[model samples]
Target: MVINLSPVYIENSLLFANTLVMLAVGLTLTYLTTKVPNFAHGSLAMVGAYALFTIAAIMFGNQLSQLQLAQPLGLGFAAAFLAGAFAGLLEYLLVLRPLQKRGSTPLGLMIATLGVDLILLGVLNIFADILRGMNPVTGTTRDWRLKAYVIQKVAGLSLGVWISFGIMIGSLVALYLLLTRTRFGIAMRASIENPALAQVLGVNVDLVNMVSWILAGGFAGLAGGMMAFVQRINPATGSIEVVAVFAASIVGGLHSLLGAVVGGYVVGLSETLLTKILSDITGVNLVTYKRAVPLIFIIVTLLVAPEGIMGINWRRLFSRIRSRK
Candidate 1:
């Protein structure tokens, strides 16, 4: 088994892994709330990335080239993270909540979200065009290599790449603590399980959903912001990442939280490692279908383990666990 790998592959793999993790988590929040598979989640991530980009441009503005978000990191990253949260909140208010109030079906909500995605992308494109004129070839919305972006180091490993991994780990840890150790988490879980039951128990379902949307959006934004410099971003960049993310989430198990994170890294490795091999193997222009690597992995997972690597019986495994002998 000759493993042809390199530092570049590691960096790229980590990048994708981080992104897939964010997308999966974002999708998970929507899935929990409305039981809908939102195609628009990708769009939300994309828009948040742009928002972070704009805010960072103001905060950094060639001073450091990358805003780490507050002194904790810098104002840029913090702003982007918050921007993502705001984007999520906005979507819930504008698209999800509106339709939900009128008794819209999940499918209908999905469709409306899709429309919102397109509309938002259009708006971003317009914004980018304007920025291109003002900055004139400095942003990702324009050229691929106008200027060098991203800080080289954090506590250690290439700050730009590892920041995302840090976020992924941080989010998972935070989510774990929240879900297992707080009343709010219990209410959220209850809402995820049965909204009506939660409502009966005095949980504010609507407010809870709004908060979930905000948190999901914030995480997604953080992921996108983290990757913005790692990859050349455009208005449609989020759309490109959509494949890897959904595949990872599906691989992890549709509604299982931990499964989403595990699935993200698995999909990440496949794309980063398998892609390197496949390109050398077939020698038939892997560039055209490079993105398909995750999609193929997803298709295989769906066939082999439709229930996902975590297994389908989440209720029994995660919740019940049975009595110990």
Candidate 2:
């Protein structure tokens, strides 16, 4: 079947895919360190989004010029990252850490994340109300997006698209270097591989775990900041988006960082492009139901390959196929 490959569709896919890559990586990082799925992870992304919005609102008010908007882009992202990192660290220390010390079961810890998510959501709502009262840009506190200010393009793509792609590439490269070339990275890897052994060998496992959460939150924040350019920003935006983030991580294999990257692109592109294709053929608008794509991925991955993409033994499967041929 012939399917159109439009520029708009490609841009949308890349923007989403890049954002998912950061989020999936962050989710995997935390899971590796703490061994629990963090439901509040998405809320952390909204924190970053709000940080970016606050900066933008403070600097230019509601009437933001293209140049003015571009000026604070970097600073806003930095603020978002710091804000997200702080929130994540607080969650670990105040809630998860204390619970772990008290010997909370995995299920209990997971439920604690739900509580954290609700708390963060309420805080975001309050913050939005305060922003509205301050009147820093009309409607800046809720359903905010960069569609109006996104006037510039580079090489026929929105500048936001390039920025998202750049962030994804830079984050991956930095993570690689940090994990492979730095002493802390080595220690962190050791902790992930075997916390008891690493602790016995003089590695500070707690420190490593703390750092992982920081990195995870920072990444999520960065992704959320980028997300403002593509999607509407609201206090609950992250909660709605978390399903896709979890899908990417689970499909990639929660135990494998590389799997997150692969899953992010696969799920991101399929969600956008496949939805478009089906919509075109069926003559109906299916964008609202696009989330089903990721839900399907999660279910299929669980049933067919519970360990996800990284769990498959490709070489063995390939040998069997060759023998059959």
lDDT of each: 0.73, 0.87
**How many clashing pairs per prediction, in order?**
7, 0
Which 10-residue span in candidate 2 carries the lowest summed lDDT?
Answer: 133-142
List ranges where model 2 is wrong by over 4 Å: 1-5, 61-64, 134-140, 282-286, 322-325
Give the number of the best model, judged by TM-score: 2
Write model 1 residue lDDT over 22-62, tens digit each, in one string: 88987877777877676767666766667666665555545
Candidate 1 Cα lDDT to native: 0.73
Which residue runs of candidate 1 sit more than 4 Å off their true CA positions?
1-3, 61-73, 136-140, 143-147, 151-156, 281-288, 312-325
Give the Cα error of residue 4 in candidate 2, in Å: 4.2
Q: Cα lDDT of model 2 overall?
A: 0.87
lDDT of 2 by residue, 81-174 (tens): 9999988999899999999999999999999999999999999999998888554443557877764566377788888887888888999999
RMSD to truth, every model: 5.0, 1.9
